[model samples]
Target chain A: MLTIATGNKAVAAAVKEVRPEVIAAYPITPQTEIVEQIAEYVTSGELDSRYIPVESEHSAMAACIGASITGARTFTATSSHGLAYMHEMVNWAAGARLPIVMANVNRALGPGWNVWAEHTDSFQERDTGWLQVYVSTVQEAYDTALMAFRIAEHKDVLLPVMVNLDGFVLSHSMQSLETVTPGDFVPPLHLPHAIDVTNPAGYGTLTGPDEHFKFRWEIEQAMRKSVRVIADTERDFAERFGRQYGVAEEYRYEDADVVVIAMGTLGKEAEVAVDLLRNEGVKAGSLRVRWLRPFPELDLSGRDIVVIDRDYSFGFGGVLAHSLMAKSRIEPYSVIAGLGGQEVTFDDIAGFVRDRTPGSETWFGVKGNV
Target chain B: MTEIPKEEYILKCTSACAGCPSSLILRYVLKAAGPDTVLVVPACCTSVIQGIYPNTALNVPVYNVAFAAAAACASGMSEAFRKAGKKTSVIVYAGDGGTVDIGIQALSGAFERETDFLYICYDNEAYGNTGMQRSGSTPVGARTTTTPGGKTHAKKDIDAIVAAHNPSYLATACAAYPQDLFKKVGKALSLRGSKFIHVLAPCPPGWRFSSEMTVEMGKLAVKSGIWILYERESGKVTINGPSKAAMIKPVPLEDYLSGQGRFKGISQKAIDALKSQAEQRAKHLQKEAEGIC
Candidate 1:
């Protein structure tokens, strides 16, 4: 069925279809509507799930961990500060290897207190052992959320997953989404270490030096195994719903001489830039990385890549540019743009591709030259 | 004495110190909670006492969580159990540092939501696991490693703070009195909504006392009015233990403070102040009890 919904509502709709046993979340801007809609679904009897209005984001994640380790499908949503607060438990969920799914609205962290779209929030948690997938549209938000459970809970890949969407850009913007029926795409949750009274099991135990390294290695092994699980889950979803998603989606890349690489809604904007560049007869295309972790293998060997990053690593460089460089030895012309929800239209992106030099970074629209 | 139950859910081997009162309190509570209980323990002494991974002292399932997250974790566990169609008792066992200081927000949230679980705070006075540091539950004039001279302020009224949330069952228990603590745990298990029990677990090393004097220190605490025993059920408060023996004058504060090296050479002025504070609190409890049914 076709319906008009914001990215937040799309996530809620997908979660409803998955039918998680427990939903725990605290309201944070851009992420608030997702929980509000879930609450509505619970109250309206559309979804039979326990909704815990947790006091803080830390508790929200803690509660999710509580439910998740009990063989229950659990979910929660949060924005920048909420995500920061949930930092400790966010790491806990992944380290414990619970297949919990969370829809994180990508917002910039505060000191200046801006609640705008930025990748820095989720990017900071890059090493927390969570499989992070950034979505570009309302439809992808709905689709990726549904597939997250299957990917995370796959026997070989029992790790937490975070589906990140651009805070205000995708979270609040209305777009048409094709809703799928509740299918067997995601199987019933079965946590091998679930708390059972008949056969009790202890979780998140204290590990000493002798055994701690082995536990850490196991998480890494599961994370590596998720690449295959993610591919398989997406394939199954595509077969069932006739819509496909990949770890990285390439658009007009085959014949293009230059390609723009990005994640989230910036990728969608870059696609538009590709079209404009093509009309000008410039061989330009876009490679949108959907999954940040299980760091997808990309063939950026032949093409000159222009990496547009909505987030920066302070003293270092753009996250996407750094990843691409680390993977394929591609010297990406990293352009820092749209930070804290600063406007980066197709024209600005096209101009970046047209005027950029190879190697190093360029701070788009900033007065200072990099 | 109702013949304290012999059922034990804790294992014989524990990583706790020789005189750790928390282990005894946990053993007794677990005995009452039975086999169908899941403990959500935060960063406290119990976190270590439960032992390292692959070797837990607990026979029942335990979810060792981060500090300041026991109540929230238990809240989730309770809801999960309810969803799973299991009637298991979800319990949270935290220390003074985790409970009164760091974990209070989560505790208050759980209470407000009326989450069905038994929240226990094993008050060992200071952060005993971290080696005698000052915490919100550290009493007045008691010297911890952090408070070299002596703690300047009185202990935070955690029981009264929890009571403000109006839990289904609320009680203050002492490890020195095992039967009373066990009975309270059993009673709390019988109730439905949010329940909280504050257990004064005296730490020998932290209190600067000999390992053998753990029980004696706990008894003296109650006798000196430093640790009062009481229960709050549906807004009613009932004083228990030595505090209830109002007719016989309470034991002097020095009786509790004198022997412990932590309180060694404590001035008479500080003792008087602590005594006055305890008296005022006891009097307030009495007035509050009179107003209740």
Candidate 2:
């Protein structure tokens, strides 16, 4: 049934439906509401699970990892500094192939210390071997949380997954969401039977110099397999929930000259800008990246694209822009703007697309230098 | 009292340093912890000491994680086992550098979560694997590669830091006192929540001591009050051994310093300062113990 709810609540309800055995959480802004609601469910006996109230984001993830390796469906949530705090565990979870799911409310990391929407938190952990998916709407956030578990636990892709939603913009903002129950959630595809202690297999065992390289190589191979598993899971999700979203979602790209690729809640605004540009007779479209990691290179072929990056990479202009250019052929005007929680107004995006000329790469919506 | 089975648990055929205090401590810990334990190790000297694949000295399953990820990795493994309905103890063994320096953030996180596991940090003071570099736990007036004559900073108060986290149990031990170290490990294993035990394992190579002098140096360190043994529970401190004043005769700081090359260049003034600091610290610990009593 479709219900009006905030992104945080939608994620909480989705996780509750998944019926994870353990929910380890530390209260941080934006991400707190998800855990708070889950805690209430657990306390009220609505969600039958152990809810560990951790002292910090790092510990929250640590507890989740412990629970996960024990063959339990484990989860945790965090944002910005909390994500940074759990940075080390992010790699551990992936390397261990624990299949733990996390919901990250995207927030700006600070010198100014603002708790607002940005992509830095999730983007910074790009290399942590997690299958990262950014959601633009409350419904997508709700759906992605469910699909994440399926994709992560797949035998061919035993890796952790992060479902990131923009803080305040999506996490706090209320929208309509369709909920799925646990009964309807499992039993679709084959998955490894819950870690069997009876068989007594060891996990994350010590790898000395002899086996260390092979162990890391196996993790990398699993990540590569995740690209295919992501597609398969999305297909299964569409069949189950009547919604289709996978690595990338294209809107009116056929016969279009310029495409603006983005992820998270910013994609929603970019869609609006693309529609306005189309109405104005500009050859522009939007590519909403559902899967941020594994880079989705298959979608970037033969296109002149403008990436609207919401986070800066310090020495590099935009992390996503740099990543995209590194893999695919770059068209003119791959601009970076809307950083540090700066508003990416429709006019800001429309102006950039309108001013774009063939072979002119530009960073739009940014003040001063390109 | 049941005597510890001192049937030489460590294999003489193994490939650890000739007089590695950590190697001896590990053997004792494993024996006390028994065969049912799972160990999580990070990138440290112990990882190398455990030897290459198919040549490990340990009988328990050991997980070698990233340098800064032992706590998190162990937590995940523990959780997985619990979810699968397994009843097994999870233990993480880290060195001073891994536990007190780069891995501290992860360690702090694990403690905060109250994961049901035992975390043991073998404090040898410096980064032994990387050739005796100074770590956060390196003591003041100790010469390491980074701290040539003496470390400018004092060793971090890790016990206090851990106690502040309100863990279920926290204790300090030294390889010199096998009974105390074994008892603490056994106690930590019985606790359900996060438990921390810091063992002062003297490094013969890093401390610039002769192979045979490792245990002697550890004994002198405690006798001089430079390495105190205490436990904290419910925010209360309890000293395990005799109080500084109650001791028959406190060993001179020079006796402890003389065995280690790291402290060979210490001036008389510096030694006197160290002695006073050790005495003051022991007194404070005694007071805390008294308050608990």
Candidate 3:
């Protein structure tokens, strides 16, 4: 069915298509619409799923963990503070290897108390054994959410997957999305370690030092193997739905001299900036790294790269930029922009690309830093 | 009266401390819940006593969760079972520290939402799993590792807090009284809405008593009018036999406090305070039972 909906609604629509057996969630701004839509579906008898209107985000994730362990496909949604509050269970969900899917509307954390688009929230959870994919448009959000279940529940990749969309930017903004009745696309989940009522068992028991590392290694092994699972899932999704996605969405980079890289909505804007730079006769391309975890290699080789980060790591610089430097051993012009839903237009992004200085960092809005 | 089931969900040879009644409470709880049950345990002694992986001491499924999350986890597990058209009992077996302290919010949330599950908090009055640290459930004038000089505050009234939710079934049980504990679990499972059974489990090592005095300690608590055992089912409160008898002619409070090492250096003032509080609590329960509140 083709219709127009906000990014949040698109996620809920995809979830309805996947038809999770259980959904436990608490409302948070920019992400509240997702859960509200899901609740409406559950209430209207359009969806046959257990919807738990939990009091807090911690319970939301914990409930999902409990349901997921029962061999039931489960989902939940939250943003910023809610994500931060549920940080502990977020790690446990992965450690327990429960393939629970979650939609996180990217929003900045508070001290200054801003509830707006930023990547810092999910970035803080980068080390947690969760596969993360940031979507740029409502269509992509719906598509990735559908594929998330298939990828996370794959036998080779029994790990939770986080679908990220910018708070307010993509989450509340309406866009055209084509929803599909994902029958047979996402198969019935079979959690090998799911609790059985007939047979008494113990899960999440204490593991001495001797065997603890082995479980961690198993998670890593599954994560490393998920690269293949992700590729295959996305390929299958493209074949069935006629919508193609990749680890990184690259545009006009075949013979460009300079390429701009970003994520979420900024990644989409970066494409416009690339076109702007191209009109000015600048040989620039755009590369939006979609999947943050199981991070895609940009293949920048011999070209000057400009990386924009909507999140920063205070002392370590941009997470994406620094991680790329460590992995690819390349110096990219690192620019921190669009934090706290701060306005950064295509002109500003194009300007960042035009004045690309390798090995240097710039804070876009800072008076002295830029 | 239903005879106690002979089959045990908790097998012998676990790592529970000697004279620990928390495990005993679980033994009865599982027997009542039976094989069609899933025990959601947070970071408590039960988590350890359930044995390490590949060698669980339990015959029923146990989902050991993080501290302060047992109730919330059970809410999900129960919903999943019910939605699947299965009547698998979801029981949260947590300790005092995980209940009255760290896990209180989740507990309140689950009960208020009317999650169909039985929550049991085996109160040992201290953080026994963490080497006897002081907990909110620890009584006044009792010492824990964290309260070296004896605690200054009275025990938090978790029963009162839980009553505010007005669950379908609510009861207080002692490990010394397994029959009562067993019956409460059976009743709670028979109903549909949220149910809670708070068991005052005596810990010999944590409380500084001889291993053999675990049941005796629990008896003294109820006999002395300190820890009242009762059931509040659908708004009617019935003080149990031991507490009802104590109300008419209670034993001395010192009989309950004397053997516990946690109260070795109790001041005269603290002792009087403890006695007064216990008397006031008993009066309130007695009046409420007689429809006098």
DockQ of 2: 0.32
- What overall lDDT, based on C-alpha atoms, would model 3 receive against the true structure? 0.92
Question: Best candidate per lDDT, number?
Answer: 3
Q: lDDT of all predictions, in order shown?
A: 0.90, 0.79, 0.92
Error of 3 at A178 (Å): 1.5
Ranking by TM-score: 3, 1, 2
lDDT of 2 by residue, A208-227 (tens): 67778886888889989888
The residue-by-residue lDDT of candidate 1 on B117-147, one tens digit each, is 9999999889988888999988878899999
In angstroms, how far off is A351's CA in candidate 2? 3.4
Top candidate when judged by DockQ against the true structure: 3
True contacts kept of each: 0.72, 0.39, 0.76
Chain B TM-score per candidate, please.
0.96, 0.93, 0.98
On lDDT, the stronger of 1 and 2 is 1
Q: Candidate 2 on B167-267: residue-level lDDT in tens?
A: 99999988888888888888888878899999998988899999998788888888878888888887788877633432447787778888889987877
Candidate 3 residue-wise lDDT, A41-125, digit = tens: 9999999999999889999999999888998999999999999999999999999999999999999999899999999999999
Q: Give candidate 2's error at residue A155 in angstroms.
A: 0.6
What i-RMS does every model get? 1.1, 4.2, 0.9
Q: Which residue pairs clash in candidate 3?
A: none
Is 2 or 3 the stronger prediction by DockQ? 3
Chain A vs native chain A, TM-score per candidate: 0.98, 0.93, 0.99
Encode model 1's per-residue lDDT on A1-370: one tens digit a residue: 9999999999999999999999999999979999999999999999999999999999999999998888899999998999999999999999988999999999998889899999999999999999999999999999999999888888999999999999889999999999998567788988888887777666777788899899889999998888888888888888888888788889998999999998999999999999999999999999899999989888778888899999989888898899889998899899999899999999999999998888978999877777
